[model samples]
Target: MSSLLKPFSISDGPCESGAFRHGVGCSKSLHSPAFDPTISHGATAPGCRTGTTRTRLGCTPGIYHTYSARRTLAAASTGGRKVTHPGKAILAGGIAGAIEICITFPTEYVKTQLQLDERANPPRYRGIGDCVKLTVQDHGYRGLYRGLSSLLYGSIPKSAVRFGTFEMLANPMRDETGRLDNTRSLWCGLGAGMAEAILVVCPMETLKVKFIHDQVSLAPRYRGFFHGVREIIRDQGVRGIYQGLTATVLKQGSNQAIRFYVMNSLRNWYKGDDPRGEMHPIVTAVFGATAGAASVFGNTPLDVVKTRMQGLEAHRYSNTVDCAFQILRNEGPVAFYKGTVPRLGRVCLDVAIVFVIYEEVVKLLNNVWLTD
Candidate 1:
């Protein structure tokens, strides 16, 4: 009779036999140092990438690292509890966002240029190459980054939603620090991508797209982020801010999904069998670069439509379909993906920075909170 009651008795007393009891200890451990699996397990040397924690793998290492990272986090993640690490995520997101915005602005400018056929003298731009040359000729090399001001305004919030939501959303799936698969990463990518699309992206992207594509402004060609917002609100009204929402949803959604999926996949594959924390940041960054390139290739077309739609006069196209058709008829197929290199660079940096920060911040939080 007592043997039948083993499961129920778990909550009645300490898990003296080292068995988890309804995972209460996982989060309960957060409040006390002794309960922490990570501290209890202890850290190994640099080469020991999760070598101490043995596990089987038919799955990628993102799962392994995610599972490993969760030792303390799982313990800390009791209902209504989380491993507080906002400061670290913020620092990482900020620095990475700034770098990504600066490096990618040129590509964004060129991409925007390709999509626009502003009804103007010489029809605005002959082609992407022509636009680049003209931009340099008229505004100097700096013209290639036409919307840096807006990018700065947009990048931080974009990154915050991406990284913050990724961390927050992925917290739901775990097997008491024992599961190993990239499931968490898939969810992270999906959640992060959706959060970014609906929130920060619709507006800043509209402004950047409008400013980059056309030399003229119905009101103002993004004089600044705030100025652009004011003009957009004053002239086109609030709904004017989301011109090609469907197209944007496709492009950025694919971008973020590819980014996290590939980034974590690489981390998992290279991490091999070892104690989890011993993974390499540089390797992860390189993987980010590759994943970013792949994502850009698939999603560039929708981005083109989104940009073109933003700069166009109302009724030019009711939605992304008309915008995409207009581009296909006018610019040919190649226009969809003109500024690939810069975007790849930007995405690579963004992914790397977010990963490092999230991981490092989580660790720092555990150390402080668990020790205190």
Candidate 2:
């Protein structure tokens, strides 16, 4: 009988052993000395050992304590890592962008040249293969990177603004568990895209397009990045570098929204409920590539319009809507996807490289700087 009665003791109740069903009718009087009534409801009691059980219609003190400790640790770790630091994001993004542009500029050059080609009576190049052949033949292999300087100059700031803005916007959207949901991530991405477009991408893109177009022109005027920038400013003022602001914003905003939405969704799925989970670099690259492909398909039309608006012949089109209208009416709807193939390749590699580098850089920075 003493053995049977032993289980009813305050220190060895059914709650501690998880013997009670639904924790129903479990008396507070049977609670251990560690279970303080003065403690707030649903909070952990001091000195309680964690347990997978409930008591008095709520989680046992031990479970509450375990959960509380987990939350505290999560908060401390997150704070210590400074994951949302704008400066860190900017540095990482800039480094990633610089590296990515260097590796992928050839594809970017091809895409730009293709978009600028207006399907002349005698097309300058037959297709992707012909374009590459002619560029290499006429100007040597370096022609494949004709406008690299302009892109490199802009890529750093563009990516910096993008990631910095994203971290700033996303930090607030995270839940108590530090997880960012897909919808909020999409909005944050859009905001980051718009910010980067306005702050850096438009002028940089306009310069890049003009440089690439000039390279293929009968008389290539600009000698270098500075020279071209000066000439554009001398000829058209500051607006010359911002030729397609509206189109750029639209394209970039949609681009990031799609990429980040897909990326966040994939990450969430991969991580499940573990917000602090880390992914392998290869896995991150694959996810980034998928995200890039999604963005390319989703907004290639806007990208084409943006390219055209920033090209040498931009004056022919009045505005964003007019550019699209003319392309649809004269060039046919297919023209909207003119550089889809090259753009797809460049974007996939670019996104994958940028994300992988950015994540690794952030980790490095976290180790060096241990403050929020």
Candidate 3:
């Protein structure tokens, strides 16, 4: 009894979804014989399956006790109608991705350097500031973003697919399970991460690494993306490109679950401020910074493994476990967690950028979606 759901009443509205109401005992109409009106309606009556005329869906008199309690409300707002299911997610993703990239760019730049020069002096980049200064001093500001083109090539689409899938799948999955607990979030995150990893992420990531480590442009350097792709296939075989897929899955899956959980929880809490009441700029900034930092911190070890695994010279481990264990045995367990400082910086930047960007873009896309 203590664990039971406390009674909570949602404001009544004109429901229109084509769902059946139980016990409301059916429309004596022949078409929807199962249309019982006894149960509370989830939506308006379903459309005629065969274009049949409406049968009398009259309710029984005895069961239909009318409660005449009237209540006042401004309006039941679905928060600015949208054009498509993917629109909001895509907008959010774009915003998130843009922010993520900008904030994390420096950290990424350092990561690329570390991964490329595995044997470079100083081992991995020390602190975020040191890395930035070293990069600018040695390679120039351009060096700070050496692999940006490739990063964008993969990151944008990868993020779009990643978050879009998460949002879309989460919505439907929640509908199915009737809840959004951590389990649901995990599955949704897994599905989303896997989909993006295989499709958009793997190759783009490969390209980004190729650029960062090798200092080559995405295309032409090793042929084109396809040609480079072909070379990797010809030499290392198809599996080569997906070198760090498991690490990616680990990083992305966890990142997505935490990101979605935090963002959604916060959004729900703020729903009281309809018209998206403006939080203090500091609050937004802190949210963006903290979320990015949290995801980065949580997934840094995985990212390190993924980066090293992806950089696997010609012959490396055949599988994720092999690579992981090999690193642990040869380089020590700490090796698997290389680049923590940069990762911390990257995550902080990513979170701030993503949330702020996502919010702004959502607002814009909402306006646009509403118009169209």
Candidate 4:
């Protein structure tokens, strides 16, 4: 009888030689008689606990195995971390945005200036270098960050909405192995982009462009961020701050879609089957820069239109469609890529910094926040 009762491994289950090896615990010892092999393998023993632990003493191997497999699947699917809460994502994204914008605002200023320079007879600045030179000559080097306050104010909420919405959308789309395929990643990014555009980006972007345009004007009217906002509202009404809703939505949607799709692809390729894989900061930067460059190429035309629509001279066009038509008709096709170079530099660095910071912050948060 003793020989017959010796522990034996169940090849198909988490239990090995009648011991709970997958972290599930049992109140009674596995070597006890409750685990008698003669009892039907599927039947519940008199002393066995219910739920996942039921199989600890071999009372229900089938159900416990299924539960264990599901746990394994979930861990893999989520990269062994809890799905980031919206609040945590918001904090991480905001930090990343603030840091990134500060570092890259000069390039942003140059890009906006080029985009707004519509004088065909004599372009305001020859190119990126000329734009920078002229800006420094006219307003000093600090001129390169003329409208940074508005952007800084908007960056926090813009990134918060972007990352929070992405996590919310992506949590459900991951496959059994916890991988987000390119198609699903693109959809998630698109959803996040649209969310940010509507929630925080449109008015913020409009204000930033107006500020930069005002700064360059012969007689700048706005005194500062608050004064400028109030004046804009007084003159153009609340609608002033939401000048380029359509173009912004299109640009931002495509921007994030391309960025996230590329980032996801690169990450998945790097990590292979290990969702929990950690990346070196350099590797993350490379992936982010690549993603940013892709987005810049994919949506620069839309960005040009968006900038024009939100600039101080927006009233020339009747609407978003008219705005695009006017640029195409008057400035020609090359005009659509007016600030591509400055934008490329800004966006690549911007994305690289943002991803590295955001990921690092998220990792720190995950360490402190316990998840089941």
Task: Report the Cα RMSD per candidate.
Answer: 14.2, 8.2, 10.5, 6.9
Off by over 4 Å in 3: 1-84, 99-103, 115-130, 173-183, 216-238, 268-282, 312-314
Clashes of 2: 0
Worst 10 residues of 2 by lDDT: 27-36
Best by TM-score: 4
Candidate 4 lDDT, tens digit per residue, 1-372? Answer: 875687433432544443443346432223312333433434345666543234444545444455456656765656554366777888999999999999999999989988998956577788888988988998898888888999999999999999999998987777655678899999999999999998899999999999999988889999999999999999989899999999999999999999999999999999986876789999999999999999999999999999999998899889999998988889899999989999999999999999999989999998897554
Lowest summed lDDT window (length 10), candidate 3? 65-74
Task: Identify the superior model by lDDT, candidate 1 or candidate 4.
Answer: 4
TM-score of predicted model 2?
Answer: 0.81
In model 2, pairs of residues that clash are: none
> Which scores greater on lDDT, model 3 or model 4?
4
Write one digit per residue (lDDT tens) for candidate 1, span 1-372.
Answer: 877766432234575432334445522221122233432233323334432332243222222244446555755554323323444455456566766677566766765664455432356666667777888998799778777787788788888777777656555553333233476776667668877888878777887776665454444355666776787788878877876677777777777877777776776677644314345667656676688777777687776666666675546777788877766776677667655554555556656655665555556556665531
**Model 3 per-residue lDDT tens digits across residues 38-150:** 53333333563332323365332211111111111112133332123566777578657755675467677776565444432346555556767876886688777765665
Badly placed stretches (over 4 Å) of model 2 are 1-75, 78-83
TM-scores of the candidates in the order shown: 0.67, 0.81, 0.66, 0.82
Quote the positional error of residue 115 for candidate 2 in Å.
0.7
